[model samples]
Target: MKMQRRSLRIEETLVKAFIYFSVICVVFALFNILWHILSHGVGLITWEFISSYPRDMGRAGGILPSIVGTACLVALAVAVAAPIGILTATYLAEYAGKSGVMRAVRFSIDTLAGVPSIVFGLFGFAFLVIFCGFRWSILSGGLTLAFMILPVIVRTSEEAIKSVPYEYRECSLALGATKWQTVARVVLPAAAPGIVTGIILGIGRSVGETAAIMLTAGSSLGLPTSIMDPVRSLSLHLYILVSEGVSFEMGYATASVLIILIFCVNLITNLLVRYMITKRMGAGAH
Candidate 1:
């Protein structure tokens, strides 16, 4: 009996050690990549580099147009995906309970989540650019990205909504609140952080996307005047600089800017989530 106990203890220690080792490896890899990009790219960042346009095939000047285009694509994609995703999530979690239709819906979302981004690009190119006649523009790229990120939002939002305790819904209903009122006031408020997280994830994917944007939104360095106009995103610009052998210096600089942009977005959204949580807590206390 003592020997078996000792064996179990050794196994547990080994498991714990393995987990710690895995975490350290992941963290080290992340930091190493960040160091590499920041070391090379940080020096190239400047007001002129940020505010000016590419002069010689992205070898000289700034990435202002690419930055603007990336923002536009991410914003448009999130705006389109968030509402639809949230609503679908709400339906799946709150209303559709253990039905065949619900199962099918869940299956579809899962499948979509696993689909490659390049495949989405091809679909968008064929459907939106050709069939819908939107052509190669921000509109097509944004819509394509919306489709790509929709499943992520739906799955995350659904899980978040489900995580809200049923007791909260019951209490709201007991207090003479309707189903919609309970969901709107109690459930959604509780799930806001998770929903925001999903949206932020979608934004991150959209921002870093290159292939989809390349296929749907033509690589135009000029600043886009409208959604109908083709635009170049930072990821695509970086790809061009590297793939076409424009300039590694400019490529690294663009990569650094992209990283900074994503970091800022995540930071801002996290702050917003904290504010919402704080406000909710204060209101409850009052």
Candidate 2:
């Protein structure tokens, strides 16, 4: 008995040590990358650098166009995907039966989530850009990104809705509420945090995506004034700067800005999610 207990203790200690080591490694790597980008890029972050248009093949000028494009792409992608994803998730979680069709749908969603981003880009180019006649514009890019992030949103939202307690549904029904009303008034509020998390993640993906945007949204140096206009995102700008050897300084600066932008987005999303969750919990308590 003592020997068994000693072995168990050793196993537990090893597991704890491994967990801590993994966390430390992740933190170290993140900070190291941040430090490198910031150190190289900090000097380039002048007001002019941020606000001016690119001149001399991106060796000079600011990244305002790229920044704006990124924002528009992310916004359009979320606007397109959120409602569809949420509705699909609700149907799968709350209405769908365990039939072969449902199983196929689940399988397709899982497969889509695992597919490469390049594949999505190509599909967008082939379908949205060429066949649908959207061409290389913000509309094409946004739709492509929307499709790319749909699987994530659907899966996350389904899980969130599924996680809602059965008692909530039961109580709502007991109160003579209709099924749809219970879902709208009780279940959805309870799952808002998870739904919001999925949306945030989808936005993050849209922000960083390069291939899909490049293929569907043709990289233009100038700012886009309409949905049908092509635009260049920050990620694409960084990619071009590095690949074309325009200016390592500019590349680093772009990288720094991209990182900071993503971080800010995540922070704001988390804050909003927390506020919503807290408010929901308080309401529940009352």
Candidate 3:
């Protein structure tokens, strides 16, 4: 008995040490990357650099067009994907039960989650760009990104909905509420944070994507005035700057901006999720 206890204690200590080491390694790597980006890029982050348009194939001038394009693409992708994903999740969670259709849906979602981003781009190119006549434009890019992120949103939302206590539904129904009423008023509000977290993740993916957006969106340098107009995203812009030897300094600057933008987005999403959770907790306490 004593020997077993001693072995268990040793195992516990080893596990804790391993976990701490992993955490330190992650933090160290993140800090190193951030430091390198800031040191190389901070000098180029002038107001003019951010506000001006490219002058010579991105060798000079700013990334205003890229910034605007990235924003528009992300917004459009979210608008297209969120409602469809949420509704699909709702049906799967609340109504599907243990049917064959439910199984098929879950399998399809799993397959989608594993599909490569480049494949999604190819599919989008073949279908939306070629067949549907959207062409190489913001609309094509947005729709492509929407399809890419749908699996993540649907799975996250379904899990969130499933996590809601059965008692909540029972009580709502016992109070003479309809099934739809219980879902909308009781379950959906509880799952909003998780659903929104998935949306934020999708937004991050949209912002960071390069090959997919480039294929569908066409890397035009000019500011896009309509969904039909092609545009260059920040990620694609950075890739071009570095790949074509346009301007290494500007490439680093664009990388820094992309990092900062993602960080800000994640921070804001985290705050929103925390606020939602806290509000829910406070309501429960009352």
TM per model?
A: 0.88, 0.88, 0.90
lDDT per residue for candidate 2 within 29-127, as digits (tens), equals: 999999999999987799998999999889988999998888898899999999999999998999999988789989888888888888988999999
* Per-candidate local distance difference test: 0.91, 0.90, 0.91
Can you write out model 3's per-residue Cα lDDT over 188-237, one digit (the tens) per residue? 99888888888888888788988788789999999999999999999999
The residue pairs found clashing in candidate 1 are none
Alpha-carbon runs more than 4 Å astray in model 1? 1-21, 268-286
Error (Å) of candidate 3 at residue 196 is 1.9
In candidate 2, residue 205 scores what lDDT?
84
Clashes of 1: 0
* Model 2 CA deviation exceeding 4 Å by range: 1-22, 272-286
Question: Which pairs of residues have clashing backbones in candidate 2?
Answer: none
Q: Count clashes in each candidate, considering only residues at least 3 apart in sequence or on different chains.
A: 0, 0, 0
Worst 10 residues of 1 by lDDT: 277-286
